[model samples]
Target chain A: GAGVSQSPSNKVTEKGKDVELRCDPISGHTALYWYRQRLGQGLEFLIYFQGNSAPDKSGLPSDRFSAERTGESVSTLTIQRTQQEDSAVYLCASSPGQGAIEQFFGPGTRLTVL
Target chain B: DQQVKQNSPSLSVQEGRISILNCDYTNSMFDYFLWYKKYPAEGPTFLISISSIKDKNEDGRFTVFLNKSAKHLSLHIVPSQPGDSAVYFCAASSGTSGTYKYIFGTGTRLKVLA
Candidate 1:
């Protein structure tokens, strides 16, 4: 893991329950990303993976959002009925698929819902 | 719709000076550009990047500037410190046919006031 890693750093839940959030990337990093940061705003991508395949989920945000990744190195982002604007923070990143390169982050998870 | 826009949410430099941060994009097919730095719950690091055939890019104290005819881009942090405050994001990348991602902006919270 030398870098990206995310999990229950914080979570509240109440609105409609249902939540899951996890990410651990940066071992050979074949892309992988997911973002969402509300409060002060900025960063909202939501999906992107390469090795585990996910050309780009066009930035979820509906259908209760969804995400998945496998051997490419753990990733998960379900969020079924949660609301309260879905709270904030949930970030995770990794890269090395080249092209523009540079990404590597993960210290987030802070959903709230309530 | 919000391709990328950081209309200044906050900024207050002082420690040593120079903090400029701004970004705007309407998509000219992007062409790659980046600048990130967040720190509250962590997540978000990469700090400089620019390539649209290059307008400018630096590292040390950070510097990035590009203006693809006005799509605009900026980020300069000369001496400003206080650990450089935080929250600064601006990203854009397009590369369609072969697939690519990254699009962020809605941050600017530098405070650095030593």
Candidate 2:
């Protein structure tokens, strides 16, 4: 893909089910970030990855929200036991080694918790 | 408390008019600021950015103004077009606590009328 790619553009899951969203960032980019935006609200930072290491995970809403990245490549955000409040569009972005570079975004994975 | 804030939830502008979107931040350590535009079903795309050293930056019809003392910033689009209709987001970063991450605003939706 010429730009960032996300899997299952749309997902509908039951309240108690677990769901995993995937993001494939631009090739050669070293920094990847995950974010969530609920309807009528702004975007919230979920997790950030730099070359496979996650030093800051403070944005995760709860222990149920976990993400993993494989160095500048693919990233997966897993939600354990979805809830109604978990519904939102999960976005991913990649840039060239962080600091001051423009971030390119993916189409995003829309998660709808039922 | 939100480190980055966009007070207006929405804005309306006629084609060929100017569209101004504002953002405020409480963090003084922020060294970089950026603006992003997002459309429905799509992720945000980087529009423009400014470093703390400069108070104003412009690209084509889009200009961004920063006020360091007031901790405020605004984006202006002269002669706004219908295509410019979308949600604009403001983000700030002083460098992640360790790895340098950005903080994003809630977003302001702009409706450009023909």
Candidate 3:
């Protein structure tokens, strides 16, 4: 079975530009999540989607960060007006359902805001 | 404030030796804990987990021990191998709070000498 996958394995952009990172969860997964890992830091939760309910955006650090998932499959995390602080490895993960304990993760997209 | 903490930044062990990694949390609400292993340029993979109700959970050579009263957890690997060398992260979540999000700690890099 295919594990979760992310596109544009590495992206470098100017500080003011906007970047969109894509994630493809494993087939049939109903819960998806986005997280960020800065240098020497832990994985920071960004947002998550479960079924058709409103996405959990509590972890979004600021309004500039947003994410959308079409149904239960692909998800895109967008950062508007990127800053150097936004440079990090953006990871996506999915699980069987909302309460599932184990999550399958993608390789992640490394975004460098220059 | 950081809720989860992995005090050790790195650890080294000889092959066939025991490797132990520890994690601590400031939040008493966390009831579920998980351990993940990650390689360079890759996303984290789920390794093991333990619930607050259980003091320990074991799987093969990997075991996770939880101490709710101390707000701490530990992952132990017996007879460690070189393949087990990587960055290990511990995550905590408050399942009883009805949120499916996890708070991760700064990873601990383990080096298993062959």
| Candidate maximizing TM-score | 3
Give lDDT tens digits, candidate 1, residues B18-111: 9999899998988888888888878888877887989988889888989899989898889888998988888888765434477888888899
DockQ, each predicted model: 0.27, 0.65, 0.80
Q: Write the per-residue lDDT of candidate 2 for residues A22-104, one digit (tens) a residue.
A: 99988998888888888877778888888756446888999999998876688899999999999999999888875635888
Which candidate's lDDT is highest? 3
Model 3: native contacts recovered, as a fraction: 0.74
- The estimated TM-scores of all candidates read 0.34, 0.95, 0.98
Q: TM-score of A-chain in each prediction?
A: 0.32, 0.94, 0.98
Candidate 3 regions exceeding 4 Å error are: none
Specify the poorest-scoring 10-residue window by lDDT in model 1 chain B: B94-103
Clashing residue pairs, backbone N/CA/C < 3 A, model 1: none
Q: Once superposed on the true structure, which residue ranges of model 1 sit more than 4 Å away at CA? A: A1-35, A38-42, A47-57, A61-63, A66-80, A83-86, A89-111, B1-14, B18-30, B34-50, B55-74, B78-86, B97-109
Better of 1 and 3 by lDDT: 3
How do the residues A1-114 of candidate 3 rate in per-residue lDDT, one tens digit apiece?
999999999999999999999999999999999999999999999998998999989999999999999998899999999999999999999999878998889999999999
lDDT-better candidate, 1 vs 2: 2
- What DockQ does candidate 1 score? 0.27
The lDDT of each candidate is 0.85, 0.90, 0.95
For model 2, name the residue pairs that clash: A42-B106, B96-B100, B96-B101
The TM-score of chain B in candidate 1 is 0.33
For residue B28, give model 2's deviation from the true position in Å. Answer: 0.9
Candidates ranked by lDDT: 3, 2, 1
